[model samples]
Target chain A: MLDYKLLDALVAVIETGGFERAGSELGLSQSAVSQRIKLLEARLGQPVLVRSPVLQATPAGQRLLNHAQQVQLLERSLSRTIPALNADRTRLRIALNADSLATWWADAIGEFCREEGLLLDLVIEDQDIGLRRMRDGDVAACLCSSDTPVAGARCVRLGQMTYRALARPDYLRQHFPEGLTPAAFRDAPAIVFGPHDQLQHRFLAQQGYHGRFPFHLCPSSEGFVRLALAGMGYGMIPDHQSLGEVKAGRLADLAPGEGIAVDLYWHYWRHGGDFMERLTTTLTRKAQGCLTV
Target chain B: MLDYKLLDALVAVIETGGFERAGSELGLSQSAVSQRIKLLEARLGQPVLVRSPVLQATPAGQRLLNHAQQVQLLERSLSRTIPALNADRTRLRIALNADSLATWWADAIGEFCREEGLLLDLVIEDQDIGLRRMRDGDVAACLCSSDTPVAGARCVRLGQMTYRALARPDYLRQHFPEGLTPAAFRDAPAIVFGPHDQLQHRFLAQQGYHGRFPFHLCPSSEGFVRLALAGMGYGMIPDHQSLGEVKAGRLADLAPGEGIAVDLYWHYWRHGGDFMERLTTTLTRKAQGCLTV
Candidate 1:
């Protein structure tokens, strides 16, 4: 069996990308980190670390690293929740899409946790990426935009998130005199969350219009929605997220008929712990009221 | 994040039902098991095992037990396969139903492992139970009767396993002079695998026949089939399993038109390594030839 301390030290080293830096971060001597690696290699009867100026993990090292990370996360959750848990108290770690996190999802989680006397650890990421974090054991549960559950996780359809192309009323009026067509979109300035975001790009690509735009890549989901509301550029936003802005006439639907419907799923580890089960039940109930489809 | 060792020790204790028994099973001294349990309880700040000569896990303990068992199995797979793995080698662990194991499943696994240069571990149980094992991380993949994949596992249709109500020809002839009827089956002796075995019961239930029988409960899948072949009582046997006996005139289909078609699914861990992927691909190919709709 691998030594827990050595595995921890190895992961720290890998994460830091250097033995000295990792040692400093972990409050250990640099030589201690190096020795731990050597001991781990000896136990496995194979070289685990490639000792360049920068530390690089070997395949064996990567395997151990992955397992170690899972173990580490599980350990953290146990320490936080198990120790504090009484019949009256619970703790939950949840991953959610930023749009949902900013919309009704957080309110639901907050209300449920408060009523149940539970602690909530919220992770905000894109819906597509949030499920992967749940799979990797980073969170106990997730709200995602996928009906198909990742293997090993139990998934229940929360409902659908309807996304409408939205922009400031003035921008749409100026850009759509001849109606929003594929040709006009090619030269239109756009606002996106980041380089990895493909929502707007996908909408364009679906219409056989592959175009590049000068983009204001706002990193924050809330900020991006705000920028779109302020007439920066056209962007796709979930109806729930843009509802207030749209109702207040700060933003208008770019193309009412050309909306995307993403089915939302609530996925969790199937271990049936109280925290996870409660969260699943609460989310399922709240989704009935929150989702449009 | 619960301590992996604590979880493992807790599960072992729960499985064995006592510290002494668990210690003996795990090759540890009773005192060591006790100390480990104490430390685990201390770390979690809660008592996991309720001790009174025999041990029982608390609800929280049971939750941890399930997670621990799953993580332990995954760790075992990682330990066994990670060292031997190369770009050219694959390691697969499959949880399979006992009926399938006795029929054509093992041969498929064997041939696939041989061809792919994969090391394979087989966890055998009933179809209903096999999927639970897959979910618990006992195996990387499984063949189950469920169309729905266990939470977190990928599911694909393997094919349909068809079963015909069968009996020794002489026994069937004697019992069904006026054709097999629900009234006659109510008093007839039946061959079933065990208390959990439901195939025969399901067949009878589907026919709206609520009947009690003097059962020859053979626990082993192979043994039950053999007992059926030896004229112990009527039983439902897979068509593939009874083919040879039927051809040899030893067994006959009691209700040829009233057969049950069980859809078998291949489910695997979503985060499974290369071995699981290769094994699933190979088994799917082999099942296409073996299973009849």
Candidate 2:
């Protein structure tokens, strides 16, 4: 029931943003792009976008975009399966977060991509949002925070990604000489991944120090640890990157014997070839090996 | 009319994700958390959250969250205005992207933070989505893609980030010897930033090649160029990062004269003290100096 032209227009709007540029990208007039979007919205009986501040998909719009992307994937996979139909190579799009990329996902999956002759398009974003991308059919699969699967997708629990509250020994000595009290937290800056990363929040909350605390915003996961080690601030760093530093006396665990554990899940769509199934098996095993036992 | 207790519960839920966990975070029972959310929703007379596969803010929800965060920022700034209230160091949360942080924003803003006696928390996210955070009152300002300001924000055109179609000379010889034709595109793999980055999409559309092509998933901006140089795939590399390689003959620009230009913008809340104004002046001057004259 979805019109290809209309759907393409909608996608162009979301991708390029704004009607004028979407039209330019589609080689259509701005009015044509606007009219097509309106037609699609009318057909759907719901507004597809919220356009005042910036163009973004409404919930209904997101679902339709998902439908379009799923159709594209189906076509791409079909061409791969039936080489006579078309000769495009198979490229698997998987959504993941920064920590997984900086830690284990890429290395573990790199071999799989080579062996299966599969190209990969890693959609890196917030883990929770990454799974949403899978549900929206933006990516075929995602490694995300949720243990629960999206309606049609399958979910597998990968072991917990352990994050320990870490600080340079000198930072601990200077700021938390009397241990991590509310006053220490107020004085000492903590390095957070970004606005969305809750590792530091959970750590502080668990320690029962709530209120506005000083924090350094370092977006990179690896970079977060680097800053912490450089004595810029305390941070919750993944054990993969921090264990060695902690052992070498370069970094100290702020919360002794206490660590934040986020249980990761691998969620994938129901339909895929043997490659996907093998990937799931491979990914799960590799994660178990690298993550907390 | 909004209850602070209920809002706190909502913030906990948004931060920690699930109801049970959010309850745990707030030191309340799961039922208590659920009731608080339902009460808040009832009071608002509108559904705030789009609860399903992922926990995401609806437009209405985003507005409420923004209001809550704005109140927090107001309180914090009030302390700075009257040092007698609470002598905590003022932290300015600003949202930006990895490219800016990796390239020049950090160096440019470092002096401002030092001079203004401001502790900066940089929230690195997707530029458009980061502006969404600014709209939600999560950050004081953001560097984003929009020329139009969000509701009560101001927009400043920084400059354009130029991206050129780049690959190794060997890659160029193998894939695009006939220039960037449709056939060449189908055969050559491309390195893309992520699912949402449209730099390459704009380039390929300009070339009139609409087929699904093979692509390598490289998430890092600088890393995107590195991978392209490593012969993993051809990609649209940022002009700042690509120029050195192109000059040294280490990389070749496939499209010759053609390039993709994304005009960057700085958006901030309309109302601010001298610090924000000074930052705007400094940032604009610095960007003008480094970016294309």
| Tens-digit per-residue lDDT, B46-142, candidate 1 | 8887764234667567557545434544554575567553332233445666567556664455455334434333445566666766655555667
lDDT of each: 0.65, 0.73
Candidate 2 chain A least-lDDT 10 residues: A108-117
Question: Per-residue lDDT tens digits of candidate 2, residues B1-293?
Answer: 66889987886676555677678667899899989988988988887777764675667776676566555556556766886776335556677776666565655565555454455666667776787677677678888777878898889988878778898898788778888788888767788776566777788889998655667766766556655665667888777767778999989988887987788888987776455667799989888865663
> How much does candidate 1 score in TM-score?
0.39
Reference-based lDDT, residue A255, model 2: 90
How many steric overlaps does candidate 2 have? Answer: 1
Using Cα atoms, each model's DockQ against the true complex is: 0.01, 0.24
True contacts kept of 2: 0.25
* CAPRI grade, predicted model 2: acceptable
